[model samples]
Target: MSATSTVRRFRTLAVPLAVLTVVFLVISLPPYLGLDPAKARLPVPEDVPWFYPALVAHIGFGSIALLTAALQVWPWLRRTHPAVHRWSGRIYLGLGVIPGGVAVLAVAPFGQTGGPTGQVANTMLALLWLATAVAGYRAARARRFGEHREWMVRNVALTFSIVANRPWSMLCIAVFAPEVMGTGPVDPAVLAQAAGVSMWLSWVVNLLVAEYWLHRTRTRRGVRGGPTAKHRQPVPATS
Candidate 1:
């Protein structure tokens, strides 16, 4: 492989690996090492009986979506078996629509922040995730291949928010949590709220970055000639 190709391959592999590693460490290590959920548990929204189910659905399907996304992006796997990639795409869409949609509904009333900001952020995240996936599928069906690719790229980036959220949360905690940063003592509740805000920020930032990258890549390749080239018609000869 050329140097550029090698670098591209490394990047493709490295991003997923880094994302997965961070997510795994955050979910698994933190709970196991020192972070006690009982201590961490803030008051649940009393009015939302469905909160637990929604939380389960959010984390469950979210994790599946993340793993499948990683697999879909694996260079060797995708290059070797296009069928697997396609099948995984279908599954990812299904997961996003059902579990992700339900999770959104659940979040609106029961988000961690438990206020207007949390509700808005979680609702927006859920809607964006669902919209991007539906848009991607529609584009594929309409044979607007470029749009499909762009939409799917955005959808996957949103899904990867599960991976991105923790790192951003940690950064928020470091900045705002005096206990962690060894400044003066700070309110744990305030730090928790800040972390919740960070989660939404991470996903929004990722979506924006993904869209920018997609536009750049598409523009660089010249809209007339990338993977979507076959979708266009030949110019007719002049008389």
Candidate 2:
């Protein structure tokens, strides 16, 4: 490839790879790695018995989404055997539904953020994520390839929130830690709400960036006739 082409490819790969790497490390790491025992923490409320199960389900499904997302982007897996891609896609879709649906249920009664604004934001995010995933699956089933691809991209963007949440949380704490420490520490309740909002916001930003990138790629390829070109030379024009 030309220098320009190489640079373009590098630019295309770098950000997503960095984001994915950070996300994978954060999620895959032991849960206790960054814990501060002195900080205000939200323990699962014993009064609400279902909290533990919901949290477990959320994390489990989030992990499945992350794993399958990484697999979906593998060139060998995606291009070499599309059958495997399709199978994996279906599994990912199925696995996502339960947690995505339950997220809506859990967000409202979220003990950490009980107020109206928090409830509304959490509910909206959950519903939006779930709806996008469902729309992607439906579009795929209907053989609307372009729509399917777009919706799936959006779904994956939402899925990335699972990864983005941690980094955002860390940043929030870092910036506010001194104030928090001085003023009786950050309330776990407020932190949790902020984290949730930040997580969804990260995904939304990623989705917009991905959409722009995909558009630019498609436009460039169209102009160059890169992938869809049949041949360089043309035979005599058909009547």
Candidate 3:
């Protein structure tokens, strides 16, 4: 096979991998969605005034954005049905990002575990999510498609923090399992600090990975034709 064919085959995997990730998140969510404090994975208590409503908004709209982004990233869909892509992008910005990010921003402050660290980390996540989403829309409206795609990439990475945050926190717990399990109950302060560290790490790691990916792709495009190739067309998988 030629080198071009190899690259083509490799690039084809991006959408499928993204689709699988979204599917995994969808399947993983039912356990976290209910009102029962026992069933809720978020540390926010059921008795808390903000928990249920905020949880519903975050889960409901975030799930929409997550699923929509998976489809939006498929090169075939955007290539063949550009209108669908445009409409869905609007949906992604409207019902998906607005309510979803705002819901988390409003609630994360009151509910975060880490005394200061967790609160700050989550607050940043919420702000970055909303800001990137807004920037993506503004870029699209301005017809700066490349900038729009990059902004959307950042937005999606932050949004995926929901999925990434859980596993990260669990890994942190696993690392300290001996100490935590030995104690009758882990101190709330300790739990808070752990959660804060995990939250920061999860979103930061995602953004780093995304920036590296965007940079690598642009480099590849530049190598092909001195940086004009990516500018000539919007990237389908970027959304």
Candidate 4:
């Protein structure tokens, strides 16, 4: 392809994701920036003293992870700007995912509505998030680029899982307690149940979708002997 066409293709794919990432951060970060527990977007449990700070930290770092991971997955950046990709990968893994995952562990057990189901689902999500990221990092270190990409796909799926949680929660709430859709006050128990179910639905669905996409890509590339062009163009860690 011509240089101009390559750049055009890059812009086409990267711009929309970049804008969405910015919008997501803009909507997510403002409430937590004030550092007041009372202003948290999620319901803060009165009994868990550390929940607010931990939740805030997770959101803060998760935003960085989201932005950097989005960039890391861009084909144009990986192909032409390998150095930027590696640096961003480091930031995405170390400064963002690690801390964010740790904070998630700290707060997941304290679900938004004090529900056991959410606690379990969120805990599992955090664990898998960290595991996939670490596995991706290890694969990159070993120069197993295909494995790295696969693991990172799973990692990114978990990273973006929060995006799905809101809608799922709303849908669950609407189904479980339609009264919530109206002006009436929400029932705490029903809210908790819906939140818990949504938490499970969000990460589980994202993960399944990621796996399905990976499987389809692999199947399509079976004749070509690899998953993607990325396997053929391994970005060096230093570059």
Candidate 5:
């Protein structure tokens, strides 16, 4: 076997792991968000006019996108069922994410969760998410398959941020809480700091990963095509 064989094995592991990741997020994340009007957690006040509705819309469609995107990136589906791939992609970018992102953007100005730092991070995510989705959709329409795939990879990464952002926050509280404040529950301030770091880390890390994967894919395609390499079909989905 070649040195790169292990990379291939790891690549093959991507889809199943992604599916599991989304399932975990869809199940685990909502309770923490305090979607119920009566049981909101910290970083949110007891009551606000537009908060819960926005949270519901954001989480609702975002969850749909998260799960649907996993299937959209499934290698088998992409290869054997291009129509399914295409339609699922539409549902993901159109119904699930764009609206969800817009809803979050709507809520961001209200300074819901994450406060100023989080607000900034979220707003940035919303804009980038929308831009990448639009870029992907437009690329598809123009028949620029390569560009479409790249942008879709980016949009999917941002979508995964819903899962990614939470861990940094929990980890921060876990490590820093006991050490900094000792005993009892940690300060909300520490949580705020964690939230700040997580907001940036979540999507940023995903995008960096996406860039790395795209580079590896482009390189492989070039090698497969050899010196006269030109037209290349999209590779198995690892986004």
Candidate 6:
């Protein structure tokens, strides 16, 4: 319908999503911050001495990415506080995505339960995460605001994938390998299979949903720009 209605609908979704994103980050990041490999949710492979360190780096920087992504995509922040948007975007790309992506690549090969499928999934996610962040940054630098928004949206989707992964992993385990979820000792092979399934499901579903949302926004607005600029504020020079 109208631009105002469209924006209102987006605001309704964006606000809760941002809140939940912060909630997820709070629940996930603190344990890793202690730098204890034993505290990691995934089973850290002892043979790979660097895996735990890399996993810590990934989680640490990824937490920053996820946190800043909430601010970066919030309509009110971009419209009313463009400087915050730009600075957060910079932090998301520079301090978060780049380092986080590298750390994920380092740990992908040593995934505890996902096996080769998990490794491939993680590697692909890291590559796509870095690529989208870079593309978004370049688009902003080129003053291609519309393209930049779309790219950043993709980056945000990737950032949120890990938050979605927990539920997906649990679901996969419950359905495909219920024994893995038992109180008794788990079969490593079954756990690995379930984890591999979850790894594929989580990011793929997130990306698909993101693409669908982008397409719907474009269709409704009939613009290559994913969202309307009617409420956009002038970005600060320092941004």
Candidate 2 TM-score over all chains jointly: 0.68
lDDT by residue for model 4 (112-148), tens: 6638988999999999999999999998998888889
Lowest summed lDDT window (length 10), candidate 2:
32-41
lDDT of 3 at 139: 84
lDDT, model 2: 0.62
Candidate 6 displacement at residue 192 in angstroms: 0.7
Q: Model 3: per-residue lDDT, tens digit, 1-239?
A: 79986666457634664776677677767866665656666676645777767877888888888777766666666777899999988888898988998998877777656557877888888899999998988888878888888898888888788778778988877665435767566676776677788889889999999999999989888887765433666557754
TM-score for candidate 3, please give it: 0.81
Model 4 stretches astray by more than 4 angstroms: 1-8, 11-14, 183-186, 225-239
Backbone clashes in candidate 5 total 0
How far in Å is the alpha carbon of 217 misplaced in model 5?
1.4
Q: After superposition, how far is residue 236 of candidate 5 from its true place, in Å?
A: 26
How much is 169 displaced in model 4, in angstroms?
1.8
What's the distance in Å from true for residue 211, model 5?
0.8
lDDT of 1 by residue, 22-72 (tens): 567466434323333333233546576766556656666766676677665
Residues 1-239 of candidate 5 have per-residue lDDT tens digits of 68786555446534775677767776666664766666544344445677668767787788778878876666666777899899888888778889999998877756645567778888999999999999989988876777887888889899888787768767755675654455675666766666776787888999999999888888987788652112445456786
List TM-score per model, in order.
Answer: 0.75, 0.68, 0.81, 0.88, 0.79, 0.84
- Return the lDDT, model 5, position 25: 70
Top lDDT model: 4
Off by over 4 Å in 3: 1-28, 31-38, 45-48, 181-185, 229-239
lDDT of each: 0.68, 0.62, 0.78, 0.86, 0.76, 0.83
Ranking by TM-score: 4, 6, 3, 5, 1, 2
Give each model's clash number: 0, 0, 1, 0, 0, 0
Task: Locate the minimum summed-lDDT window of 10 residues in model 1.
Answer: 31-40
